[model samples]
Target: MTIRYPNGQKFTPVPLRDKREQPRDHVTFSNRGMTLEEDINATNAYYLNCGMAVIHKKPVPVQIVRVDYPARSAAVIKEAYFRQASTTDYNGVYKGKYIDFEAKETKIASSFPLKNFHDHQINHMKQVESHGGIAFVIIRFSQTDELYFLPFQALYTFWCRMMNGGRKSITKDELTACSIFLPLGLSPRIPYLDAVESMYF
Candidate 1:
């Protein structure tokens, strides 16, 4: 069967990537080789299972353009596009306090590049803060497998400095001084709430 575009043109699939070219697992948090996002999702599941916290990843809004109805199955989506730019990655209620945060992974060990973040994300964080919600960023140094929770206040400071033509990134030293180090755990994988409880809650 040939897949055609909306305009009757053939839809050529992108070439498959080589297995060796795939992202290599760096951290042994679970000893099972999971990406940072997967680990965080597992952690959130663990939290929800035990009635600890209620954090969740925000869904990306996709506008579906076309769908194909199969013979005996549900319709399959053929085309879709994002409705708008994503704000934060995750948000929920933890102990009655509104929790909103973005998770990022970078390979740089000395400093985390601010280029990974967008202006809209910073603006959303500011909005969350103004509304008395807990806003922060969870950063993982993929090469070192080190994770840190940097609050919005600290992130804002670094962002402003970058805008002022200062350093374009936050150094590891600065993160160590201002951020909360999330210890790796066996069950949840990324036990970030421990640091949150210690610092904020």
Candidate 2:
């Protein structure tokens, strides 16, 4: 299948590993070569099962353009295009508070580049906050296996600085001061809600 962005650019998805070939070591909080999305999905599943929260990933709207009828019972989609840009990765309600967040991972150890975020996403988060909703970001330093929950306000400060011709990235030291450090665990892989509770609730 071929998918394209709204701007007519080809969208190639990252190849995923087979689950059957992966190890089932759920005892440790190690990286285990899993992608950030996979970890968050697992955490969300656990949260749902435990009745802790109701969060889900936002699905990207796509317009199907072509389909191949390979068989009478199977019709394969051949081409599709995204209808619009996504606002955020995940959203839901927790403890009666609306939650919305974007998760990103980088291998850089010194700083997290602001280029990882888009202006529309920032604007969306701001609107979410203005409407009395909880908005934040989950940043993971892949090299050091360090994770941080950065609030929308803190992120807005750096974003504004960048727009004013300031530093284009947030340093590790700055994140340590402004963001909540999240330690990975077993039951709920990335325990981000704990940080959220400490900061917001």
Model 1: C-alpha RMSD to truth?
Answer: 9.2
Residue 174 lDDT in candidate 1: 92
lDDT for every model?
0.83, 0.87
Clash pairs detected, candidate 1:
none
What residue pairs clash in candidate 2, if any at all? none
By lDDT, who's the top model here?
Answer: 2
Each candidate: RMSD = 9.2, 11.9
lDDT per residue (tens digit) for residues 1-201 in model 2 = 568889999977776775556445321222244578888999999999999999998776789999999866788889999665558879998999999998887667888888778789999999999999999999999888899999999999999999999998999999899999999998899999998899998
TM-score of 1: 0.80
The parts of candidate 2 lying over 4 Å away from their true place are: 1-34, 69-71, 82-84
Which lDDT tens digits does candidate 1 get at residues 1-201? 468888989976776654456446432222123487788889999999999989998777789999999999999999999775458878898999988988887766788888777899899999999999999888888888889999999999999999999998899999889998888888888888887788786
TM-score of decoy 2? 0.79
TM-score per candidate: 0.80, 0.79
Regions of candidate 1 where Cα sits further than 4 Å from its true position: 1-34, 82-84
